[model samples]
Target: MVNCVVKNWQGEQSGETTLEMPVAKEENAEHIVHRALVRQLHNQRQGTASTKTRAEVRGGGRKPWRQKGTGRARAGSIRSPLWRGGGVIFGPKPKDYNLKMNRKERRLALRTAFISRVEDLIVVENFLDQLTAPKTKEVVNALTRWGIEPEQKVLLIVTDTTPDNLYLSVRNLPNVKLLRHDCLNIYDILYADKIVATSEAITKIQEVYCGE
Candidate 1:
């Protein structure tokens, strides 16, 4: 079991919570993590690149000139690939870039991501709920008190519904990402230098990925 320090809203150490060793193993398969990351990145692509073909371009209905005696190569339409301002040949088309991974692959992937960053994980109790007003300085002070530097990318995982104040407070902070509990994934875990997880967030993560 790994002992994670549980810090309160005031930035003081409240207590310690235990994480199952099976779920917090430090040694993770790099290939699994890499594959999961690649899949995630691939799915994120918008894949909207597109180019018009000869038939799609307008003002191409009529031939440029007489086909039989033209000094240049014979052309059928003004939009022919051979003509100026012509449509592109073999150009890219809009496509779906999403890649799917099975349940087993995804489960292992999330587990790997969490385990790989065991040492950097900070489990904070849910004093964030008490924050009714958005205060950027409050978030900064909390992290500072916890000894977590904010300059590096930090991933904050909260319970199902992140409170309005917490969301607004961290929303515009530089290098800080606020995400809900169930949405945890390999990309954010690996991308972050440190992870600040709420108490409920840990339970949710363990419930979903610890089943493996």
Candidate 2:
């Protein structure tokens, strides 16, 4: 267990919290990479949006020409991919982009990512109290106290439910993102310069990644 000290909105010392560092687990690097890639693919697909294809465009119902009669090649609907303003050829469709990775692989990737973050010294003090609401300045001050820059993008992982105050406080900060224990993602972890998580979240991460 590692001891970390975090401050609250009041600028007072909020005491210490004990967290098990799961990033130190001696897991397979290959497994971790596979899991992280799967997660990246999953996130991309989950938030995907559907866009209309040219073939599905309106005003393409009419045939442009008669077959074998005109000098032009055999023609179909006006929306044919060959024509200008026609439907796109082999364009992206609205489908699931999710990649199915094995459970063990996913766990490994998460572990690997956690290890990488720890190696970078990005993981910091764990918070204990749930602030009444999110306060951007408060979070900023906490980071400043820890010698982290205010402009750094920080990922805060909370155990269980997300506190209302913390959520609201970091919402407006472009560099900061708030995630629940179950919602940790490889991209987010990789993108963040610092990670602030609760003890419960740390434990959950360990169980999921290290099986500890």
Candidate 3:
């Protein structure tokens, strides 16, 4: 059991919580995390880049000049790759850049990443209810109380039970990201310097990831 400090909105230690989720037992767990990051970044590519090839270019129907009578080099097509307005040669085409990741591997990678970052996790009990309104100043004040600097990247993990005000409050804040436990991914976990989670959010994660 990994015991962690649970803090309130004021950054005071409210209690101690244990991480039921499995921790990485391997010393080389970071290698799996790196693979997961690479897979995530690769999967994000749109792969929609396209270019017209010489064969697909139009206006090449008639020969520009006789095959062997032109003073200059004989041109068979106006849209030759050598011409100014010619089609691109060996240009890019739309392709799927999506990388495949095994489901078990992804889960293990996430577990490893969370274990690696467990020290940075701050459990804010009743975080959403702390501030009733969607005020940026209030959010900033809460984070400030938690000793979080303004420019620090934070990932707030919430759950379906969390209020809309919490989402609206932190969306525009600098370097702060909000995600439901269901939507939690390895990218956000690795990108954030600190992760603040509501007790409810922790419960949700435990249900999905701590099942063993």
Candidate 4:
């Protein structure tokens, strides 16, 4: 359980909120979180890299020099590994990089990672109504008021009910990444220097992750 200060759009402390989630034990917290991170990063790989071997290359049927002394070493095919424009030797082939972890372990890892970043989490009131239109400047100014520097990376957590205006307003800000509460991941949680989450989004996170 942690206490977080809730701020309004004006960056004033309106109230406070409590965050309680089931995190892993300290003994293996790092290990589980590391596993989850590696799994996620590895699973994102396309693994579509492929290279043709000598036998798979085209135009390799006829022997290059008939295996006889023609003032040069005999060559079996033009597509040999040693020849120019030839097939690759021991090259990479398409493969699957997906890694698996139990659902419970994955959740535990996520909870642990999220909790570890408690110091950087900033809870703010729902300000969807504050933005009447898609204005990037408004979001930027709000971020500045929220104590976030312009250059700092921020992970803005919103709820599914959040309007597209907020999305449009924040999309142009390269330093800010907007994510939904339920779609939260360890990568984004740990990647951002500061996490700006709406009060409603925080509640959704607690409900989904804490199972409350």
**Residue-level lDDT tens digits of model 4 in 1-212:** 89999999999999999999989989999999999999999999999999999888889898767666688987888898999989999899999999999988888999999999989999999999999999999999999999999989999998863568988898889999999999988899889999999888888888888762
- The lDDT values for all models are 0.82, 0.65, 0.82, 0.91
For 117-156, candidate 2 gives per-residue lDDT tens digits of: 6633333434536355656787777767655687777887
Q: Which tens-of-lDDT digit does each residue in 68-150 have in candidate 1?
A: 86577787798888778889999999999898888777778778678779899989998666677899888888888877876
TM-score per candidate, chains pooled = 0.87, 0.66, 0.93, 0.97
Of the candidates numbered 1 and 4, which has the greater TM-score value? 4
Name the lDDT of candidate 1. 0.82
- Those runs of model 4 whose alpha carbons end farther than 4 Å from true positions after fitting are none
RMSD of each: 2.5, 4.8, 1.6, 1.2
Off by over 4 Å in 2: 1-31, 46-81, 85-88, 119-134, 160-163, 207-209
Stretch of 10 with least lDDT, candidate 4: 62-71
Largest lDDT belongs to which candidate? 4
Which regions of candidate 3 deviate over 4 angstroms? none
Clashing pairs in 4: none
What residue pairs are clashing in model 2? 32-108, 32-109, 133-165, 134-165, 134-169, 135-169
Candidate 1 lowest-lDDT run of ten: 19-28
Model 4: what TM-score? 0.97
